[model samples]
Target chain A: MLKIMIIGATSVIAQETARFFATEGAEFFLVGIPADKLVVIKDDLVARGAKRAEVYEADLTDFDKHPQIIESAVQAMGSIDAVLIAHGTLGNQKAAEASVEVALKEINLNLLSNISLLTLLGNYFEKQRRGCIAVISSVAGDRGRGSNYVYGTAKAGTTTFMQGLRSRLAKSGVAVVTIKPGLVDTPMTADIKKNFLFSDPATVGKAIYLGMKKGKDTVYAPWFWRYIMAIIIHIPEFIFKKMSL
Target chain B: MTTPLNRLKQYKSWGRYPTVEHKAIHQIHWRSDLPDVNQFEETVLPYGYGRSYGDSCLNEGGILLDTSYMQQFIAFDAEQGLVRCEAGVSLEQILEVIVPCGWFLPVTPGTKFVSIGGAIANDVHGKNHHRAGTFGCHVTQFELVRSDGTYICSPTENAELFRATIGGLGLTGIITWAEFKLKRIPSPLIDQEKIRFANLDEFFAISAEMDQRFEYLMSWSDCLSGGDSMGRGIFMAGNFYDPPLGAEPSAKKLKPFVPFDLPSIALNTLSVKAFNAVLYRVPLGKRVRSIVHYEPFYYPLDAINNWYRLYGKRGFLQYQLVVPLEGDNEPIREVYRRIAQSGEGSFLVVLKAFGDIASPGMLSFPMPGVTLALDFAFNGEKTLKLLDELDTIVREARGRVYPAKDARMSPENFRAYYPQWEAFAHYIDPKFSSSFWRRVTASAKSANGQ
Candidate 1:
């Protein structure tokens, strides 16, 4: 049975991605905020055929707690054979635009906290010598847009960090997969008006599960997002800045 | 908390009919975050996937508390074929988890995309209704969150509310999660057979015989067939194939999708007639047999996602009505005759017999009846007129139209069909209401001068 650690067990995308692992009779060390929601996910993973799903309730934004959280999860699961960091807020772009404090807070939760967990897990996995490390970055990181630049900045930082982690651990036999998903319908994006560009969480989740299992280096969920993001990324800065995306 | 994304959104029932008035959506992602039902200034109703064909799952001028993200599996017992899952979990998702463990849904509707909560609220029946009854019959327990508080409902706990909630059309409250039993299956593949019947009499005769041995039975009828050929169509029967069956149960594959609406001229009467003729001649009463995957056996149309787009911009209506089995099937034969006369019937038609097993839901639609369901492209007044005539015949025959598939049944007809609405109304959550609830209840109340 696989032993895995999921950082954001409560989020819809995280739960959906975790389900693939669960059905394979994986054992889980789940960490997320809100104890009740975490417990619900734990029960859910077990129901989906997981051998065990242990919950470690923690506010992932609390950076000081990162070491303890990682240690506790690894201890609880015996030892993690794979790790997925799937927690982050969309972080209201308008609110962040209104205040520097909001922007920093958004970055702290989405970028800095993840970096802390990565550093801790990085050391543990590097010593263990074999494992898959996956993180959910977003296509928004390809190029910042006015509508959600705050979130874009955080995702961009995350993508860059995973890139460095991948190269640094290349010889250590540690695999790093960076997942950039576009427009997934989850509670995080519940407020967004959905269109053809959007896909259900299950679709994106299955992609993540497959990418992690295959140890793909960099991936885009739902495939189409790659072409969409490529077009967006190639748009000239002069014309792009004039148009609201 | 409203954002650019939370602007008032126009939602469509799967059938895309009656044009729902716009409503703001408040998403409920976690049980801990469930909104206070009484707190919304606009009335509230839970919306899950909008898979219901008509307005039963919609709300006009109210907040749609969307529960699609509330999907999660709570418990599973492969040994006993028991599962408890969040209400928003789709049958498709459940199949992914349980099919490997050798369990299957006790009952399933045509589409696997429907949420468990929607299935329960509609009390959807399936081909296996002859043996398994409606989906609600297997729901062992669920959590209903109302304006008052959360209540755990089952047959023995809050029993009346449980009955009302089943087939309650989101009026009772939000079903946060539910527990139900699953039937054991040897494998996910179906050993299916097809035979063409000459007419309605032969169809019924063969159906009854197949019901004795098969776990699933259904028929596809030519909607425009009449007189001697009336109800002549293909009868299909199947059971889950036992043993590994020499082939691994293949994974659910990506379905081809209709990316955009087909033009209105694409499915006219002549075209539908030609298609029906081709289908009718292919089977030829040969009793062809094959071992097929359950995906195709139960949901052939699902092979193409958004296949209803073929009906074009105006959308379509799925007029499904069940005529009781107590009398001669003259009324059913009459329904086919009327549709054939209208020249508006589409190629797709389904006929099935519900057995004597009674559904526990007070508002449940099945009652020892043969249900006829056909699709009609909305031709404005002409199609509406035809359906209205069918309703009169059905009402006189003590038949009932399925609310889940109805967009335009009159309030009087609805009350006539489901007289237990008064008992069910008593259990409706004070804070929960829907477009359909308002259409039937409010109009009926005003008509009575109450």
Candidate 2:
């Protein structure tokens, strides 16, 4: 059984991804906010056939608590075979644009918090000589737009950081996976307008699970989003600015 | 409420009739932050995949709590065949998780797309009703979140609320989570047999014998066969059968799909009658006995994805009525006679007998009798008049129409059919309501002027 540590275990996507592994009788160390929700996830994973499920509640944005969280997860699981960072939010775009404080807070929660956990897990996996690291980035990071550049910038940073970490970790036989999903219908994106393009959380969860298992460097949730993003990235800046995407 | 495309036509029931606009809709993802009915203007109803055939799934000028995303299995016991899951989890999802574990739903409706909450709220029955009873029969317990407070309900605890909420149609409260027993299956395949019956008498005779031998029994009646030849149909019987040693469940083959709505003229009287006539004869050539997958045997219409589109843009209403065997069976014949005279025969008509197994729910549909269900394509006032006529026949015979399949049953008829509705209304949450509830109880509300 794989010993996996998942931050943001309360996320619908994260819970589904964890469930995919649970069927295989994997062990888990879950860390997320709201201790009560985390307890539900722990029970769910155990019921789904997980060998063991231990939870730690902590606000991931607190940089000071990063070390303590990582240390506790390691002590709980004994050894980590894989790690998935699957928590973030789409904060109010209008608020972020009007205030620099709002923009930085979202950036810190979405980008800095993940980078801090990766920093600790990266070192641990590197010295251990074998493991996998996965993070749920988004296609919004592929290019910036007026609608949500603040959230985009944060995801873009994490996506680039994973790229750099993959090269460094490869020498020690560690694998790093960066998952980039398009619009997903979840509580996080509940307020956003959705269409045929918005995939359900369950489908995206299975994709994330498969991408992590294959240890892919960059993966798209619906697979078609890969080609869709490829076409969008080629649009000229002058024409793109005029189009109200 | 989310997409521009979906915003154009808010939401619809399975029948796609009496389309109503809701003031707002909230998508629930987790059980913790469930939407409170008091927060929204007008009435509120929990909507799950919109499987109710008529107005029961709708709440016009009100709010809808769409709980399709609140799907998560809370607990599972493969050995004990007991599983618990969030309310929005569909029967299809449960089947996927448990079928591999050699277990199956104790009772499943025609389609696997219906959510667990919707199943209990409607008290849906299956082909095995003669054996296993309604879906609510196996439910051990569930958490009901009402405006007043949350209540843990079961047969032994909060028993009154439990009975009321089973077929209460989402007015009692929003079910957060539910736990039920699963049927232990030796294999996923079923030993099925089909025999032709010439008339209603033959069909009933065959059913009586089949009920004693098979766990699943159902029939397909040709609605066009009127006069002395009326009710000619095929009887089907099935029992769980083990597969050959070392056989594995095969990957699902691609199914036929109805991608878009067909023109309203596609199912005209002549074409529908011809199709039904052809369908009856085709089965005669096939082998009488075969080992088949349970999914196909239980849900043949689901073979085509979105088969509802076949009814066309105008939509169709499923007319389902049941009467006890203690009364004269002539009411059903008169009902079918009216449909034939109207020249609005549907392509598919089903008949089945409900056994003596009593349901725990107060307003559950089935009893010690048989039910007949058929789809009537919406054709303005003419179709409505025909339905009203049939309702009178069924009402006078001491039978009742199914609320889930009804769009326009008269308030007086509903009052007479379920005399317990007056007492049952007391348990309804003050802030929860549905279009069907309001339509059926209009007289009651106005007479009391409360």
Best by DockQ: 1
Cα-based TM-score, every candidate: 0.92, 0.93
Error of 1 at B343 (Å): 1.9
For candidate 1, chain B by itself scores a TM value of: 0.92
Off by over 4 Å in 2: B1-9, B243-270, B285-287, B326-328, B444-450
User: With candidate 1 superimposed using the best TM-score fit, by how many Å does residue B47's alpha carbon deviate from the native?
Assistant: 1.4
Docking class of 1: acceptable
TM-score (C-alpha) between model 1 and the true structure: 0.92
DockQ of all candidate complexes: 0.43, 0.36
Per-residue alpha-carbon lDDT of candidate 1 for residues A157-179, written as tens digits (9 for 90 to 100): 99999999999888899999999
Question: Any idea what lDDT model 2 has?
Answer: 0.84
Give model 2 RMSD, 1 decimal: 3.8
Per prediction, the TM-score for chain B is 0.92, 0.92
